[model samples]
Target: MNKKLIICALITFISLPNLADDETTLSGAELINNNCARCHNSRPVREFSISEWRVIMPHMREKAHLTGSEVKAILEFMEIASSPAQPVEVTLAKSLTVNPRDVLTRYGCQGCHQVQGAGGTLGPSLDNVISEKGRAFFLRKVKEPQFNNSSSAMPQMPITDDELEALAEFLSSI
Candidate 1:
């Protein structure tokens, strides 16, 4: 009777389905594709400042209706992706030098400032900033963002001199 009981117990245990460790966490790419890709491109696998990523990811998540875990996984994957030290390639896709058009879109400057017939209207028009302000004025305005309009709703832009020069040249060319 003991042997039979032991045999029955073993059979019951063997027939039971696994209850633990059945599921694995999703990969970042998978999470992004499943959630974010529906609305926007999975954030460019480029070196994004933590603030930049943080600023953008929430919007993407909100649009996609993704859960917190899904957002976290996608961000983790983006952080692991090998991107350039600077946003050089993304800025230089059109040419070796900066493309003003590209810069406007990449930084979402278009969302606020108007370029040569493009971009948003929340801020002043930059249609002729290249010609009107010139390089010196442009530099000052960009550097001292609060000089002209202390109450300007625009956020202080943080970019390097090289990027500034490239952007200026591109704008001037346009």
Candidate 2:
């Protein structure tokens, strides 16, 4: 019984660090989703460049009534999300298996754009934007958000081609 108790305690101790990490991650996403939507729609983490975010977060923190630690978590999440995309060599088979909705959530698309009667309102509702705009146009816009409008505020999303295709098709259907 004493040996079992020791092993259990050791296992719990080993898991504590991971539990903290999980809590922080969940809180960061949850804080943004819950708090930001109270007054205005939540912006996507990739909406601003890191430098831009550095300048913007303080003001937003005050406006959003976020604590320092809350802001830190959000900033960390933003920094991770805004980093340049690493090239991923996705095979055709892998691409075929990609879930479009997961891609959208991973990239925080719904933070700015509404889809299927849910999501934020910072950007246009995407329920029919893809169908209204051709798939080629949607693809170009996401790849280079400023392709047509040099002054557009939309950030270039760090997404793979497979993910983009999947998202486009998914959005088009909605």
For TM-score, the strongest prediction is 2
Off by over 4 Å in 2: 1-96
Error of 1 at 92 (Å): 11
Using all chains and alpha carbons, the TM-scores for the candidates as numbered come to 0.43, 0.46
Error of 2 at 147 (Å): 1.3
* Predicted candidate 1 versus true structure: per-residue lDDT over 67-165, tens digit per residue: 777777666656545433332112223245455566666667889888777779887777678698777888788767778888867666776666777
Clashes by residue pair, model 2: none
Q: Write the per-residue lDDT of candidate 2 for residues 18-132, one digit (tens) a residue.
A: 4356666667777778887676686667776888877887898988899988987777766655665544332234444689989979988889888888899888888888778
Error of 2 at 162 (Å): 0.4
RMSD of each: 22.5, 16.9
lDDT of each: 0.66, 0.77
Q: Determine which window of 10 residues in candidate 2 has minimal summed lDDT.
A: 86-95
TM-score of 1: 0.43
